[model samples]
Target: MKLAYIVALAAGLAAVAPASAETLLRIGYPGTGLDDRPFGYGDYIAIGHVKQLVEAEFKDQPDVKVTWTFFRGAGPALNESLAAGQLDFAAGLGDLPAIVGRSRGLATEFLASAGSHDPLYLAVPPNSSIHSVEDLRDHKVAQFRGTNLQIATDRVLEAHGLSEKNIRFVSLDSNAATAALVSGNVDASFGGSEYLDLAKHGVVKIIYSTKNDNPTLGRNSGLYVTADFEKAHPDYTAKVVEAFVKAAHFGADEANRQDVFEIWAKSGLPAESFATDFKDERLAHRLSPVVDDYIVARYKDQAERAKAYGLIKKDVDIDSWFNTKYLKQALTDQKLEHYWPTFDAKGQKLTDGEVEQTRAATN
Candidate 1:
């Protein structure tokens, strides 16, 4: 009865209908194992959760239906989809990709970060000479041009007194670069923590990770959507945002960590360490809904450092990229205005575990 009622409510949420609004949302899921299609088992579950929550919240209306589009990774392919006007909500992207899309007039906006943690893992082939972040001074390093890795790689270089010209900056996608590193085609490769599984399996070793010294460089993965898309489908956008905000809570809790980890593990990752490595001390406190002032301040810092490091165009303004209306609306509607740690820290974790009170309206 509950499921049927909920399903009926989310019927026509696209434009708003008597029953519900009808929406055609094209979401990009990182295609991996479990679901050969981008909407794998986990993603399908997330989408279903979004649908259920939205439906449950607005049961009075029942006519919104969602469509989806999936991608392999966060690079050229996803960018192409955004350019073609076929995407509404996409996650797991980096700041570099966000910058390039905007530079090319992609009409996209950066929503709240998925969770602040975009550490660049500097990897080198085992049995090679480079053992420290500074060891690659005279050697060439590869990066995914116009991606988030570029910003991180550039920052590391600038801090070490090395520039792009000092060592070759080969532009390649994640797989290509990983392949290059494996075949000794490049001295080092810059990738995200998502690649940690590769390191665990001895595919490569992390000589320097963004987590090494600079903690702030590892901000949350970018969450964004096209401006036109947002405007065209505000309710759909609202629902999508709500799903992610809630998932942050679900993904962080110790009890639910395994479920989320299983989702990540299916993509060739280990569940335990992936959960452990993501459990940050301070930043985890301001995970969803309420965007801590520090998180915003950090974005400013990263943007400045990235420009100084020559990873992004100086003209890109970080402040202008974010839109908090949806986040605000999601929190207000759900009544989740309080701070919740994105991860669990044992006894210190929230009790009752409800991040905030989200009661329905009283008659």
Candidate 2:
């Protein structure tokens, strides 16, 4: 009887083997530059790729393969692919596109915040008279629409009592915008750290930047997974989250700071650019995976701004969009729940002593 029972179990295991023989996790990102490399500035997903962390997590399962797809057209193109069921996971999706995707009925769960508080710069021709955001009025301004930067551009314009219609807006990717700026085709271009290099080379001058402006205008990035994918493969989703969190820990380590910057410099930008970008900032706070109050409030604000700018048809319920379970579980499983400090809705970090006091008071 025992032999018969063992035989039955063996047959059942064999029957299930083929069903789990193959699993595919398709992760999509916005920039095409990072496609050929394993890392990019401030990109934890790329770090995971460089470390082969995700692949190693599933190494024992020979059937699972992880594929990364990069879309040069940025968020809109990535959303199109997501709509077509071509991507199961996404990282580096900006707040605008993420909200827009949800408004358009793309069911995806926000996994964790990726890059946030990225300063933006408006680069004008080396000899141009443009001196500020207000100076760009009635001028040709290059902006990459349908991405987080678009939202930032709009906010910056509004701050200066201007709107997109007030200026001649030209939609161009980062590279094209840079070329146009240098060639005098566009009056100014809104960009990130790359613009710093242009400024250094005397090709462009930075008229305005978010260095001391409102933090909300800084573009935020997030990681997400399709609702169907999450429901169908919760285990795989959890593993992916673990891998990302592991990468984040590595990125936040002070000892690995220079190495992280070196890996990210493969995108053709100098390592010094990243160093300047992250100057005076803590990597742990910047690369935190915790879904703190600040992240929630920021997304809510971005959704509202998107509606005000006519980027979305209706309001997106930001609260319901987040699936913090994956990140929370990953932190707990990795024993890193308290490794990073938590920030308030205003982006102020609570001191460790303060956190303990708060917990004590609540208890």
Candidate 3:
């Protein structure tokens, strides 16, 4: 009779336990600031981190602890952590590294588009003679290899009737590349908005940039979760997406434009740089978290480019890798399905009527 009572009590405890109860959640970002600064840049994920959205989301669950890891080696280093099962989720994962990881048998799912249309620039020494992409040929050029920036740089070079073979390519991360450009160690450096600060300080000249240029030339990154983690704790995954989507809403609001910039500035870039980078652009469009047609098409294109550029050996199937059910549910739960506009494959905004149709279809 005593044994029976103990068994009944044990079963009752098990029944009351939360199905998705986790002791800890580990989140990672590919790029860290100088000296491995805890914060990072380039996406809503960074803004969310600064705002402690994920922490607040799990505040009620005292047992659930959230920790973030910022990788100084950038995307490639972040990929290493994910492969070793050291990380559960990756925020602001670049397209190229994610594609390469997927092709190389990293079991992960693309959760949501973290950032898109982030402009690229080519910075030369303050008094350098190089003024065009064509001039970059036969000159030393530096970029972070195995990153989304690499692919964008390749496309830009190809557009100018050149390729990596046509120039001296030096593989360096953003900080190193910026230092090289400023010290004239590299003839030019190609990177994202962070370079604008250098130009503002009269240290570098921005001869070419994707700003107001081809929208397709812009780089893309996204939130990604390892398959093992998602399979084990689906509820935790949903809660994370919901929190990040909330961050997206905060970032997309025009009223919070300056506030959003301030949050991003924590990554070591000045707030004025973000303001200048996003000038004359719609916050909602730039900060939208939805994985709509344009994002899918861009990833698909990125995969193709990766394969063609010899960056990956195997082909990555976009449909199989992209899991957006959580994002849709998050949108519906947050009543934000109609808040952010969806774009077509060519980066054109869909009409309001078409937006409704897209939401219904996803539903």
Best by lDDT: 3
TM-score of each: 0.73, 0.88, 0.90
Q: Which stretches of candidate 3 lie over 4 Å from their true place?
A: 1-22, 352-363
* lDDT, each prediction: 0.60, 0.83, 0.87
In candidate 2, how many Å is residue 232 off? 0.9
**Between candidates 1 and 3, the lDDT winner:** 3
Largest TM-score belongs to which candidate? 3
- Model 2 clashing residue pairs (backbone): none
In TM-score terms, candidate 2 sits at 0.88
* Predicted structure 2: lDDT: 0.83
lDDT of 2 by residue, 1-363 (tens): 999999999999898778666778898888755333433466677678778898888998888999888777879989999999999998878888989999999999999988777788888988898888888889998999999999888888998899998999899987788889999999999988877766777878888878678755677889999999999999999999999999888887766889888877777777787787777766665676777887898899889989988889898988899998999999889888887777677766655422234444766
Local accuracy of candidate 3 as per-residue lDDT tens digits, 215-326: 6787889899999999989999999999999998888866788998888788888989888888877677668788888999999999998999999987889889889999
**Number of backbone collisions per candidate:** 23, 0, 0
Estimate the Cα RMSD of every predicted model relative to the unseen true structure: 9.8, 6.0, 5.5
Across 1-363, the per-residue lDDT of candidate 1 in tens digits comes to 999877777764533744443655566643333224343322223433333443454454455555555555545567888888777766655555666566567777777765454456788887779998678877877877765666667667777777777777787766677778888899888876545666777878878766655545543445677898888777777877787766655544444545665665555446654564565522234234334554566556656765666655666666787898888777677666554533221112333224322211221
Q: Residue 304, candidate 3: how far off, in angstroms?
A: 0.8
